[model samples]
Target chain A: MSQHISFVQREELKNKPSSDALGFGVHYTDHMFVMDYEEEQGWHDPRIIPYGPLTMDPAAMVFHYGQAIFEGLKAYTTPDGTVQLFRPDRNMKRFNQSCERLHIPTIDEDFLLNAIQQLLLKEKDWIPTEEGTSLYIRPYVFATEPFIGVRPSKQYKLLVILSPVGSYYGDQLSPVPIYVEEKYIRASVGGVGEVKTAGNYAASMKAQKEAEAKGYSQILWLDSKENKYVEEVGSMNIFFKINGEVVTPELSGSILNGVTRNSVIELLNYWGIPVREEKISIQEIFDAHARGELEEVFGAGTAVVISPVGELTWKDQTIQVNDKNIGPLSQRLYDTITGIQFGKTEDEFNWTVQVDEVRV
Target chain B: MSQHISFVQREELKNKPSSDALGFGVHYTDHMFVMDYEEEQGWHDPRIIPYGPLTMDPAAMVFHYGQAIFEGLKAYTTPDGTVQLFRPDRNMKRFNQSCERLHIPTIDEDFLLNAIQQLLLKEKDWIPTEEGTSLYIRPYVFATEPFIGVRPSKQYKLLVILSPVGSYYGDQLSPVPIYVEEKYIRASVGGVGEVKTAGNYAASMKAQKEAEAKGYSQILWLDSKENKYVEEVGSMNIFFKINGEVVTPELSGSILNGVTRNSVIELLNYWGIPVREEKISIQEIFDAHARGELEEVFGAGTAVVISPVGELTWKDQTIQVNDKNIGPLSQRLYDTITGIQFGKTEDEFNWTVQVDEVRV
Candidate 1:
């Protein structure tokens, strides 16, 4: 064990599923990391326990007030059979930001990160090694105070569960058709849109289902105020290439600062690509498409990694990007990120946090 | 004890607390109503179970994607010692609106209302008869499917829990100091603000806490885009009395349609008072204050009924309303609404739905 963490193994470990059966967030590991927080006692009793159900009072504030936030990252099993996490410190930093916004107490990021590695060591067999497969890690915090009032909760629970899964979008990288929505909004400025809180995703589900019913993969959200400037596509930050210049919307305090978006930007800067985060409106994108300057469109997020937009339909005006194929830059970003993740390429950015090499 | 409803009595019900100890959403009744929903099976298995903790998977969608919505209404003990729910059908309608927006299934409103009455009847003794007290009924629905994906859950849990709550604010109709917020937003047009969902409240907690830290009771939000037009107050719909006329923000598809707000409007219309739902700007309110036309400001919702605003502090400018006393109009609205609730006056509008008093 890496620290003072306690573990209770399952009575009987179940057989692992066939590698082919691993999909996104459907299957879980044998154990999880659990901790609790109180206004007075602080976060205490860090332990690893058998994965099971959680018992909560019906009046838990999380059910009524939505005082919850979560972080999603993955643990990759490298080609040399070593397990590593991608930029876990960044996730922890972002996690604290969410905690601050939701009025939850902060935790020792290094302690929690070490505890995550320990929990992973306890169930390292669950890490999938097939091509494009790894264990998806979900570390989340939620209000546990048993009250229905509309105030911040004084008690909370922080849990980290591991799910061995395949690709987030599909079995392979694919360009998805997105519908530009002008009616419903995912978020607006001065809202809880800059963090990975549960409510932001809840607010976006309606538009997502509407787009899904129309055979679109996701909803391309515009700014809620004027509904002109692009905000994001589904849960991911968006990027567009026009006249060999890459552009995305500014943070604007209403869109999530996606981790993959940051990584992609870093990778773009490394490659000396002309990338800028500024206000890019839907009309501007359409104009670029009309002028043959729109080269590519893609989304970046932890879950989907890199998702290219095949066709964008705005008010029945459908247009294809890069001839309905993934752009070379998008493919390169995906390949380099995943290659570094799987240790197939050089770890030039020192992004991956390698787990301890102690044998089980 | 009711149609299509099963009951599980507690082996040893705890003694009821003294009426004086009843606080908001803290003290629960002995039992709760629960139902489950599946995409294929619809909502089924409605029953009443002993009040206790509910066991849910750690990866339940409500903890992750925040796919949940809730409604609040109160059951008043009349002077005749009979119970009545105030326009519960409106709450049911609003609940369905939230359900639709969050991609949850709607229930049979009449059936659910009847079930609520039955639940209240089973726990009738817990209903407080204190001058300003009632049984605060909370009916909530949440996504229950154990998955980490960001889509609506196929399985849902609908629960109705009862709490014997005292006054929402202080007793005796005290006027409160509200902060006029210009930084953080509650919701925007074309957003999920028009419904009673957890995310909408989650989106406001940050600003609410900020206002509270500044020594304010609640926040008075402005429009998200312009941050100019008055939207709604925290957890209530606000009304402004100016120059012998009453006005509230129109239903702009981003603020909750409070049942009490509707009743207040209807009550004003019945009394031949000039009332309108239109865009009222904060600057206009300041101008009205300057012109001595800002007569009174009160918030309306099912919990508090009517909360008078004594002062509003915006951008370091604190302006007192009605000289920091309850204005005549605010007092009248509170008195009339609460009077009808306690059966002190005639139910002219046919608002209260009298629960059938079959011998228990």
Candidate 2:
């Protein structure tokens, strides 16, 4: 799928932030990629232009009915100075799944990947080389139709923006406390929970705020139906090491299929570690802790890579995982993933995709 | 509350469409009310400006995280040529509820009411006086901060726009076929189902489209957990008159607390009709039909007022409601509501709020 994407470079690039000052989603690159979708013309006019504000109609359907979807990934500067992405194809495919669920038009994944590569090539200097810092790629689509009814939009826009960022949780290996949410639900089966749509995140902001107020950094969500089985964490897929085996929640239709999650599972399989995906409940984790079988707890996502859970507070009960420290296995998974991401280790899984210059 | 709202009038007004040609959400009025919110200044700079597109950053949190909410009501040209609104206070209150759920800051309901009234006075000439025609009012707020993380935005914008709309369902009394959705869920307990936020509507488009594909105009959603008890129809609250008694779904956490639904319940009480709010399962509705006691089925909302259900198709079973004709009770409710809205009937309920010309 060859897409003729036009490029309009910025006249003067903005001053770059210091590498050490790069925080999550705080700084943007010089240019971005954009495409438009109309019911009759489908998607067209793919272009890379200066990063700026978008002129949207006040009655745009997205602002009214919220038909928006997004994907999150990162580009890292390898030791050999090569800019590469980790499982971007998976992000694109999952983005398509979100589009399907949100009733938005799906894009040609290769076309989008090419667009990202071209944009990255143009903004190559923006990729921070400092350890624990990279360029975060956010590809999102939203309804742009100037209508006010409760229906799918006829017009849409797809945009890809880049932001230089540090560690999502301020540290690569620091174990953070997670609040087990019981009152508020994130997503339910037969809904858009499995897809990375905007509403699911919007619906979680309240619980996240309350958790933050209680000094917790993130939330551990449960199944909406029964509120018994454990789901994913705020923005990552969760894993628990119990006794001699590891277990994560099955993708029971409401959990996000994280690319980093897939990598962690594959890495465990490659190491011949006992890993399984099934309906694991929060009470079960507490029970395992009671039985001295709760070995470790960690979260996996593109932003954090691997986040070790130090403590978990559910209602009135609190349990500390691995003595409120990063477990050895968690450290190994983080090192292996980041090692491959930064080109410091072997790419045996063939997961990294190097960006090469391509003619527009 | 006295608000010092500034106004910027358009020098040349656009030509208005014929009243007969006005469809739902097709044509907009000349001016709109706008307000901004910042953590430092709170909500400031309330103004009325020419209707136009909004310039927003491509990284605006609303575009990605969908922290957007909106309310819908209508303004009618009474028989005496006065423009008035129907229970807009309820919409404002509900808008605050949505804001609380989405973690967006709330606004003073009276101040917003005044803003809407002031905007309506300026656009009063645009209100359609034709039979079954009125001006639809849409007030919405969204996160405008240019950030990309999974958190509530620090900056926001609230705007009110007007659209001259005909009857929401073409003929107000025409019954619409409803598809009973079992595979896809709309909202679950502990979700944002009870609020009028953009995510809930965005999460519903695929199911709505699928129902349309199956020749149904709307979808009747059941409880997400059990998928048995009826929740609501698309964009409306549903009620069933079984064995000559009207029963609607209670304020379950996942169901919207509709203003029109409340008005209907009150109206039924005013008319001495046996009415109750309880869990009405689809199977129970089917059983009522089996016993030849399903007297009427209708949906109530700001858009449709009272939409008679012509048929219900659930999996393999298809039931024709009232032989595909409008029921008497549905017609009476529509007449009473629209009558009060247009000032043709006695305002015994004091539901309509008159828009008075105010000093800026």
Candidate 3:
């Protein structure tokens, strides 16, 4: 695809926030990448414009029907000052998968990836250099059609915005308590659970809020049917170490296919650790813990690369894993993934895509 | 609940479309009612503004997380030259119910109803008086906070827009062919299926589109767990008549508690008809057809008060319902409902709320 990406520089740029003061998704870079799609003319008029408000019809379909999707990835500043993205291609591909499910028009993955790279280059200076901070890239698409009917929208807008963030969890490797939610469900089989759509996140807020009220950091969802089999966490894929083998729930139709989760599995296999994917149940985990075989539990996702699960409260029973501390394997996995992301370790996996510097 | 609605009329109103050309949700009235909500101030700044675009931050939470919900009701112009709304209170109550599930802050229902009534008085001319046409009123709420984190947004917006719409099925009483979907579940138990949220509608679009491509008007969704028992049709609650008894899938947690469905149940009881709400499996319906006891099937909702199901295609078998025509009972229910809405029949049920004229 030809790159006719237009640019509209902001007349006045806002001062960057201090790196130490940066929080997750709180501050945005100066410019954002935007593209519009209409039924007659496909996606066109790609541009990099000032980060500002969007003018939309009050009757846009997205407000009423929620036909929206988003991809989350990060851009990191290497020790040597090179900007690179962490497996952005996967995010782009998964974005199209979500589009297919939501009945939104799919975009050219390669073209969008290139657009993000260009967007990163323009805002490269905004990438934080803090030890635990990076630039969070949020690529989202939503229905822009000015109609109230419940159907696929004929118009859409895709935007890529950058936010400087410190870390998802205040302490990166600190283990957090998880509430095993039995009352609310995030998604179900034959539903849009596997896709990264807007609704999936919204559907999780109630449970998350309730869990937070109970002093839990996140929710560990169970299957909607029997409410027995373990599913993914609120925003991450969960894995457990039982007796020595690492096991995560298989990619059931209702679980998200996390890119970070995939990388962790590959790394585990590379390290020659025994790992398997199966339909493990909550009862089985409790049984394994009761038998003193459950070793560790953790979650994997982009925002929080590896979140160690310390305590789990299911129903009336609460169990602590690894003495309510980060397990050795969880710490190692976190270091390895962050090392790969920050370009400190060798890129043997060839996962990082370097963003080229713009030539004036 | 004091009335404090401020108004700003459009300088020049757009010409209204002809009543015959008034398709569903295509044309908007000259004005719309809007309210803003902040955590500290609660819902404030209720006003009627010109129907136009809304300025929203690009990173608004609704576009990314989809914490949105809406209610659909109608305003009708009676033959006596009075304007009234059908069950607006029920819609307001249901709106709060949806808010509770989405973790959104609830609003004052009585105050909102008063606001809508005042807004209707401003745009009463837009209400069509055609036999099958009426003003479609859509009241919606969405997250407007410009943060990208996956949590309940602190800021929100509520808006009510009016669109002059013709009959939902084009022909008011025409029967529509329904495709019984064994795949692509809409909502599951312990999920947000019962709420009139944006995600539920977006999640059902793919199934609806595929059914439409197969020459079906709407999809009849089965329960997500078993995919055997009937749940609902896309956008409407479903009912089946076998032998002499009318049956609807019970208000299973995943099925929407529709206003029209409730009214139908009440009317059936008033007429001394046997109606039951149970978990009626698709197999049972098919078996009932095989035994020559399947009498009729229809859908009920605000859009189509009584949509007779002419045929149902489940798996590979297609069965004609009531010889592909509207059932006598379906016709009577439609007449009773529309007659009450338009003030042509006695208001024995006290369903309609008359909108007072704007005094000069």
Candidate 4:
């Protein structure tokens, strides 16, 4: 590493063999990566600093205007003790896409990947060796400008933080139940729906809570204009299998173009599974379920590689998919992706990024 | 005032003169009021401290989840130098209403009002004495929890920041041109649109930018579901006069429940002006303009008491309202409200709150 890029080490952590107990975003690592962007100097001061509080002006644009975007991926410690990341280039591309949408300045992909690899290599011990356990990495950028104008902020700050996360499924992998939200729409066409911005998630909290209150795991958002077509589940892209053909929502301006969603499409294409992206209305899904044509339904995201949907409740009607278990395609996609990520499979796509040598 | 409840006096800013140049939300006084709340204990440790940066965890829920709400009102320095606020109790009530929607714990109205009054008193000299200027006060509450959960945060912070502001109309109160946005929607029914949350404003930035790019002062948002009904203009509630009837978009769950909107309703009622809060579709407004029924259009908000809509461009059609000037009723309502605010008229509705003396 270059002397200028060197970070002061301040290890303050207890070694915990609690990978099995890791929940999503609950337990963080000891160190975090940071880089400051000044208006005159561009992005600079990149360093891996100890995780702590950040002092900010109360009038910072991010607090008042919600000009923030984030990316999510994981670092996996393979069975052979090598730490690797899955398709980080895809994430960096999507991160820049989100930046373009949110008006945040873009960071160079090589620099971001280099910084992340450096940090991960130093903290490789935080990556869980157990299956379905990994070091979840969150790279986010936000407007740091102190002005209170409604315009896009000029100054921004980018930071990366890591958390050791367990399987999205606590102990066993089972399909989850979801509620159909017809009244609340997460995003609309021409809106910032495709971006992984803070505002998009903040807007969905109420709907998520309402679904959870009614004993549902997630919410299935519909298109804002018509409230008829299926858009996306919060934080995940959904897919349905009907008549042995896979159908996912089209990349309308309002739905997130997820990295995992794209990966699933590639995997399905490789397996010669017919996949279509078009407007699939709620009524059509219900009709497919009634005729027993809907064989399976699943949600795709980084956290849960492929979350099969067991049941969907819309209005007063509830539709159950085939066999409350991971479907054949879903299982295969998860295995293939995970295998590649853990360096256990052929590097056909060259998706894995190996970390450099460093001690925690 | 009790010494325990008072803020330490920082008299460095006592010599600043009130001018129209001291515009809205720009110039701050020396001190601010704050209170903290934890799940273990409700709101406590109320203090008036020097205005400065706040130390926050990078993972604080507000930055990530947009769990924040705020209210805006002004402290007017009357012709006789007596400081007063217009309908502060209404703002306090609305502030709590916004809190309930965002799941931020509420504070007692009396305590909040008293704290604001004390703060205003300390900075009474900062209240602009210019004809259209006032001291803008922003009271906000945000999630302070340092976790990445989607649920409502357990810890919260409430703060009141004051800034001396001049008239929103720079140099002149001229009518502004607006562009109707047919593509993007600001808020939707069953969403947090009615609540003055940060997400609502954040969501409007793109639309506003698009409008600004087209040389329009602000964007006129339409209903998300149909994109046909007139919802509200950016940061303001809209009013339309068609065929001698005063009509405003009803309190659809999507539009904000603006304090100025409510005040206009009451004033129209007091003046025996026939008013209706029914759906005002864009088609109806355009048809009315074609038939010479659309007489006047204006916007109401705290910043600008009444901003007349000069012209509206919807798609390819452009419609002019009364040669882009303030209408008769618009002028009367603006005068009445500002008259009452500046103590130039009788306090018939008892809507003003007198500032308490700052004891230091």
Candidate 5:
């Protein structure tokens, strides 16, 4: 898979911007890598074309049945002006996991990694130099077959697009408030909860909007079954520190196996911090709060390394943690992860993939 | 809403041979109805346009976040040369319910119905006159905003595409074999199980495929929490006849309020059948089967109306229903529902909506 390399030169960008303001996903870099998979062709037509709109049939399976999967990672411009990706192998593995669940064709890991590296190299200038900014890479696969059937699609399109993103924490890394929803479940067992598919996030928007309407930053999703155990915070995995031990929900098939969540587990283990991946019920956390054993609570994801859980509102109960400020563990975890990503710390795990320079 | 009428001429369709072979969703009608919604403009630009590809941004909310909702109904041509829709108002109301759950704006029921009628009148010829054949109408909405942020899209596009469909049950309406999955759940109690959202269907595809691999036609889902209570099949609502009583799962938040399910209840009530909506535990079902009290089991939806459940395999215990054929109640229900739909019987419930011919 690594030996087979097919690269297509993209037409020059028609309207390249200089010094543009950083917006979320509004702007795209010069090129996008695309690959098509048909039952007959078996993953052919690999090309890198100029970033533009994709023409898709109205009855495409992705549009109607939501047979779509996506992955998110970032390319950082380090202090020494070199572009690098953090733990792209993890993203690739998770991407394949998503493909398997959605019945989409899985690409060779080496091929995907090499293609993304080449794409980033071609559009390296898009990586932001600002301290808290980077180029966000989006890899998505969807059913492109023009059919109205509710079955697995035979045709698929895989694409990778790049967008420069500003700081996800906004201006300051302030602790954010999250509303606890006992009524809505984000994912469930036997469902595509562990997969990074589009439906999980789409199903969460209504509850999220309700949380925002109630003056909260995000929604903390509870387990669907009993609604007693803590699941996730939509886009991120959660952590609760009680009795000086870090506790997060075990992979119950209803919560995403986030990359950042895995990183935190490894980092905590390396730092000799006790971390337990077991069921953490809401009552236990409240009980721990009553006993002064609840130390800190935070969320981990690719966007934000660790967002401190400032306050929680669940069923007429409000629990505040660490006086609305980032806790020691949260700060340490964020610094360690970002430090490794930006090349400030030693790459003991060798997670960074160096982007080769391309001569213009 | 009725005063605001915007129309586009229907484009001519290419004629295909009668024996062209019909696949599930492969072929589509020539024209499609589209409308846009925004915060500033409530609902505008309603028109029928040539069916073709849609140009969407790579980062559109629907592509990445899965913020999509849809409804499925059909236009049937009666023997009297009139085109009609079966329980379209129910579909419209359910469509709004789905929209509310997804945070998408709702359209006026009358306006949507009028638009659909106009569109169907133009494409009346596309409706097949063959027995058990009709034009499947699909109305779907998606987030069109190109943003990477995790929020509801302010801009949305609603479109209706029509496809000619044959009988879901082939020549002989044979009862289907189902796999009862106790390990996986199709939906959780507080999830988007009730809404006709794409995410719910997306979540069920894996389980459906697994059941198919086991030589079963569908999967019988269990409650997400304990996997104790029987919920529903992915595409249709399930019902059981035990001890001379019609029993179905109650309207739990995790189950869809299917229009077909409701109509069956009404028809049963009119026919003096004792129907009850309650939590029917899997254990109870199995016990009844063992006691020879379980008379029949069938699924109900718009596509098939009523499909009998012949055999169910649950945890190494395969239970075959009486005689492995359609039960008396199922056959009668199917006859009554399709009779009303095709204008072969009295429209006691006034479920049919007539499409008047217009000189354009």
Candidate 6:
């Protein structure tokens, strides 16, 4: 019921990578947070221990059944050297939604948030202070129970690990090509598409690989039923600037409600820019491009924040947006979101949670 | 290039349960087959080591991305005191297909099959000799690399574990009620439903749990497009006897190509029974039942062999089949297939693979 903290440090700390050299999720921090769940004991033995390999039974349900859910956010360092997390509460809320969908038990959000604050303090040194670098936090809950039946397991394990990651895109704020996937589908309605679960990601590798092989960086998925309406991009929510209004697909239980997607929408509303979350079709986008109304297309997520799109290739037709350059609106939105994230701009929405001042 | 295997014995052997008490995937054998894969070294270090917990990194791709695929087959002991496998080559072939879909590297089928034979020899005593019991062989490949990008892992681990499993269904050959899932969808076209990947099972837990709560033993999933065409029953392929015609849904892109289902079709052909594989919708099935044309409904898989369905509930409408008892066709199919499995019937198709005698 209360925030519990226990620590057992490593005998020797691992060498840290230079801020410039660290890529995404390649280097890990010193300690990690872990908790276990049982049918009898609600959740027990919450502790932070040395980051290492977990000795798991080969029959563990997590490896066999794919009953696992995860949340991704980042710890950022400001100019004044204050460590903070942006909208971690949103990640926790979505994590519970994924747990419910995957048939895993939900955690006490308040207890977890408090524990995260203490963990951030403990690993504060690992938070990257480079221009676009940050410490990535991966909180995942998986079925640890060793069973093979096609049902939920009675036991689970919640683990939180940290990694120093560079900017998601090597070249910052540049536009890239995305292929319109016609054969492989990501998630259909009434499926686990909207949830940030492991299965959703596994179902998408083939499509991503095919698109990459065709010289596209990612894929643009469509609705499974008609294969016309545009869905989310590769693990990120997509937005299209058509004519003047910014259009995005609604949360139809077939696409993820990304945290960064919400922030972008809020920023657009504040700026009095027309933004709409409704069904948008690939044909409509092509028509808009034909009429020279398509301005810019971009993707939003915790990792990239905003990924500008330069060209979209569908069938045999390719359309270049904003003359294959980063549009003005995309650059402004990126600067605003990242500025608020790094605490350089005024916090009007109170989204950033500072680590050192929060009570554990 | 050649068949090679290293062995490591456990310091102490674990206690084995009685053959009758051995549940599915619970008790393990003394040793297992493990092979590692790297980008440069394609599936190296083949060994059979002590069966125990596997030490995995916290960020291992399997736990987070669900990039894992598996095969389910059993090793049976005959009256002649000889051990043999049933259609393991088919399982290996399917395993490669699953691997291709999941973007994981495939194994050398001959080398892996040779390794499984050696592993069975190493733990020959664990194979259950009871009439309905057999050693369940579970071979799985999972992403071992600890990176968090949405791509194929450069590193992977393939492991084969044996569990002395009892009969999958305790009642042997009995009829049970199944619910027709209308709300929660399973796999659809262009999805991973046809593959034995972990994500497909993960996507079905919610529907299965809901069906079980409604007093049904399993769920009968309809096609994702219209929710009318019958896709599969629980995790098995389904069949129906309508007016003396044995019918099953065709190999649509949305259902698993069950090995037992294939065998059942072959057996029906061999027996000179009328069997058809085509699009059979739930409405047509209901119409058949209304006109007293529906005779029986059943499910088939390697685990259950054949499961007779007594009743089906759709939208609060329950249809009892064959007076809530196993029909003649269902009974005949169950007996013939399980007969061949236990080595009683003639294997005219040459489905059995006898294990060569070897000792550690």
Each model's TM-score, in the order given?
A: 0.98, 0.98, 0.98, 0.92, 0.96, 0.98
State fnat for each of the candidate structures: 0.77, 0.87, 0.83, 0.46, 0.82, 0.67
Worst 10 residues of 3 chain A by lDDT: A351-360
TM-score of chain B of 6: 0.97
Per-residue lDDT tens digits for candidate 6, residues B74-159, read: 99887778888888899999989899989999988888888899999989888888878888999999998999866788899999
Instruction: Give a tens-digit lDDT track for model 3, residues A1-360.
Output: 675999999899989999889988889999999999999999999999999989999989999999999999998888888878888889999999999999999999999999988888888778898887899999989999998877899999999999999976665688999999999988999999999999998889999999999999999999988898999988999999999999999999999999999999999999999999999999999999999999999999998999999999999999999998899999999999999998898888999988888221
What residue pairs clash in candidate 5, if any at all? none
DockQ winner between candidates 5 and 6: 5
How well is each residue in B1-360 modelled by candidate 1, as lDDT tens digits?
A: 134988999889978878788888888999999999999988888999999999999999999989889999998888888888899999989899899998888888888898898899888888888888889999999999999988889999999999888866556778899999888888888888899888777778878888888899999999988999998889989999999999999998888888899999998999999999998899989889999999999999888899999999888788899998989988888889988987787899898888777222
For candidate 2 chain A, the 10 contiguous residues with the lowest summed lDDT are: A351-360
Give the better candidate number (4 or 6) by DockQ.
6
- Each prediction's DockQ against the real complex: 0.82, 0.89, 0.87, 0.51, 0.77, 0.76
Best by DockQ: 2
Model 6 residue B12 CA deviation in Å? 2.8
Ranking by lDDT: 2, 3, 1, 6, 5, 4
- lDDT by residue (B200-262, candidate 4, tens digit) is 776777678878989999889998777889999999999998888899999988888888898
* The TM-score obtained by chain A of candidate 5 when compared with the true chain A: 0.95
Per-residue error (Å), model 4, residue A274: 2.3
Residue A248 deviation, candidate 5, in Å?
A: 2.0
Candidate 3, residue B267: how far the Cα is off, in Å: 0.6
Model 2 RMSD to the real structure? 1.7
For this target, which candidate reaches the highest lDDT against the unseen true structure?
A: 2
Per prediction, the TM-score for chain B is 0.97, 0.98, 0.97, 0.95, 0.96, 0.97
Model 3, B105-164: lDDT tens digits are 998899888888888889877888888788898899999999998889999999999999
